[model samples]
Target: MTESTTFNFIDSARRTVKLEQEAVGLLSTHLDDNFTRACQMIIQCRGRVVVTGMGKSGHVGNKMAATLASTGTPAFFVHPGEASHGDMGMITPGDVVIALSNSGETSEVTSLLPLLKRQGTQLISMTGNKESTLAKAADSHLYAGVDQEACPLDLAPTSSTTCALVMGDALAIALLEAKGFTAEDFAFSHPGGSLGRRLLLKVENIMHSGDQIPVVSPDTSLPEALLVATSKGLGLTTVADADGKLAGIFTDGDLRRAIDQGVDIRNASIKDVMTAGCKTTSPGMLAAEALKVMEDGKINALVVQDEGRTVGVINMHDMLRAGVI
Candidate 1:
């Protein structure tokens, strides 16, 4: 192809994006009671929001449904053509339907309207034409109208579909705010991902408990504490009292200080040189919260305690291993 032909293709792509951006920008001014009413319908929906469209509009509707589901609104996509073929059974009286058609006259989508109505499902139409049959038959209508298409023939769904997607996002976010949806609530829906781990993985879950924990009595020698710390690979060892309560901690920092002072490592007791009043955390605390505590205290390890009794210990490395950091 000629350089001119390449430039023409690039220009077409840029024009398409520009047109869609303009459409989305204009959508803000169109936000009114209709938008609020649309959000209210979805917010009050007792069942999933069923999204349906045809062709390119269908693609946009599918994404809109997914976005709604991920962000707090329960929604799923339904193919209108498939609905006519027996998928209409997916809709129940409790569900809400969001139908998309740029011309407001997609036969496949409009064909399902009567069945959705019979099921007592609320219809929310998203179309460029307010006068279209789909819009007129809906309980509420969201106009995703674009002044023009980016297609050279002005027939493609480019700008119209983008507006519909943006409008869907607006509806989902409004409902999210209405429902007081929070990050913690979102995390519950995504428990297997990194966000879920950060929100749900507690320090208790990954901490070294029982005999696996590196703990030494206060009377233990510094050399012995060092050996335990080295063997446990936690870079530190908890020093406990006769009552098995945390008394202090001997860390690599203490080792460095002892060497600098020419202290007798084999003769000195761990309690004598250990850091007193060391930071500690409860097992019930979130691992992410524990990470923050470690970062804020500028410490790498924390002794886990319950009722003043040392139960376990966790280090920064442990947090890393558990994907908490």
Candidate 2:
């Protein structure tokens, strides 16, 4: 084939995007009592939501199942072909089956309808053809029909797949809102990701506590406090009173300021060189929250306290190590 430089690639791409956008926009018209009914069915399901489809629809169904499962709705995907191969036993009377078929006529998907109905399972179908067998058999049918495919030949499943994915997302989000699913709840389902680390990890969990905390007495010499800071490798040391209450904090910045002011580190007490009224965080605070405090205060470390008593210390490095940063 000869390269045609005059053929407008940008214009062709724009047309494809416009068509897909219109396809997704058309879904708003399909959002009626049926959409609400599907959400209600999934919400009331005692068993998990079972999503199934064929080919391209199957791929979209897998993603839909994942989204539902992560957002507080218990759901999983099963291919229609797999369902026919003894996987239909996974469906139950209490379960809601969401079947995706753009044409609503995929033989593999349609073949499961009789068994789903016989098992008394709730059926929700997403299809482009309302007249198709699957749509007619579904308890609640979501019209995912597009004006046309974005493909130049109008034979591909681009727009149809987008509409199905968006509809699935809408169902998942509506159910999530109705269930009052919080970010903490979502974190529990995604414990391996950064979101879980941010929501589930606490300051005390990763804090340097007890002997690991670099602490010095108010009367301790600045040089000795520096030694404690160096030994602990936290870049700072806390100066506490005889009662073990926080008096102040001396950081590398404070040491530099003291040196600039002509104070002798060997002779000066930690309290004299320390910065008073240092920022502190509670042990129960989320590590993510502690990072916010450090960010807002422009400080690298925070002394963890409990009821005005010094307990531990945490720094930016701790947040980084714990994957809370």
Candidate 3:
């Protein structure tokens, strides 16, 4: 036999994926009242959701806890082995505990049942065997049973772990939607991530305000307005009326158009070569929203207005510097 034909790696992967897909698909059909009950239990908990498991289940539990925490339900993972070693103190009576164990009879996890019961901590179990001791002890049992393992020997945990992870994700999302979780709420939990920056960062926080803004009066000469725009390095300048209200905007593009019309910059007023009623944005608007405005209008900057008065200017360069782009 050729060395390449000795083991068909692609066939092995396909079979494993097929089995795991079937396992997860079956999970949806088996969903019952217990799933809803578990979500309710988590939502109503005055304390956080405490997840616990052993071995591969423990690894999955850690991710479940993180997803729940980030999605509005405060949760944390606790290893059953560590729980026996005093980390169990992390689980309070007000907390809901979700335990994962494919066999539903993991000694480390099952041993915590009596203690959790005595403390009145609600238990939600994800196990392959609904009749196992852990499942029977749980206030809510989530059956994650799979017909067969994706492993060639059917002895290794393959389909079971995938089912557990999917179940955890399902629970997190259900609770998130049930609680009216919003993008802003999610941003608060992930302030360091790009989505957080896009949602939480405001226009006022990064806009060029005060003296940094390039401004010129409508009567100012086109040559002087160009100097102001160049000095500010923002490629644009705002033309304000005598009362300090925005009258127009002069950009590099506007200068090009004026030149195309044979309007000499040396003999023109700033107003003659400027764009009237230019786009504007509020200081409170999100930087992400401002980017969209700039993109939609094909403009590089916006005059920041609050009640008909220009306060600052936000340009595409500002968006880029702030990582909003």
Tens-digit lDDT track of model 3 for 94-140 = 99999999999999999999999999999999999989999999999
Ranking by lDDT: 3, 2, 1
CA RMSD of all predictions: 2.6, 1.8, 1.6
**lDDT, candidate 2, 1-325, per-residue tens:** 4477778899999999999999898889889999999998888889999999999999999999999999999999998998999998888899999999999999999999889888899999999999999999999999999989999899989999999999999999999999999988999998999999999999999999999988889989988999999999989999889888899999999998999999987899998899989999999999999999999999999999999998999999999999998
Candidate 1 to native Cα RMSD, angstroms: 2.6
The superposed Cα distance between candidate 1 and the true structure at residue 7, in angstroms, equals: 2.0
- Give the TM-score of each candidate: 0.88, 0.94, 0.95
Q: For candidate 1, list the clashing residue pairs, or say none.
A: none
Candidate 2 TM-score, true structure as reference:
0.94
Better of 1 and 2 by TM-score: 2
Per-residue lDDT tens digits for candidate 1, residues 1-325, read 8888667677778888888788899988877777878888888889999999999998999999988998898889999998899998898999999999999999999888778887799999998998999989998999889898878788877777788888988888888888898877888888999999998898899999988888899889888888998998788888878877778998898889989999988799998899989999999998999999999999899999898888899998898988888
After TM-score superposition, what is the CA distance of residue 157 in candidate 3 from its true location, in Å? Answer: 1.5
Q: Which ten residues in a row have the lowest lDDT in candidate 1?
A: 3-12
Better lDDT candidate (1, 3): 3
Model 2 has an lDDT value of 0.93
Question: Which model is ahead, 1 or 3, in terms of TM-score?
Answer: 3
Error of 1 at 80 (Å): 0.2
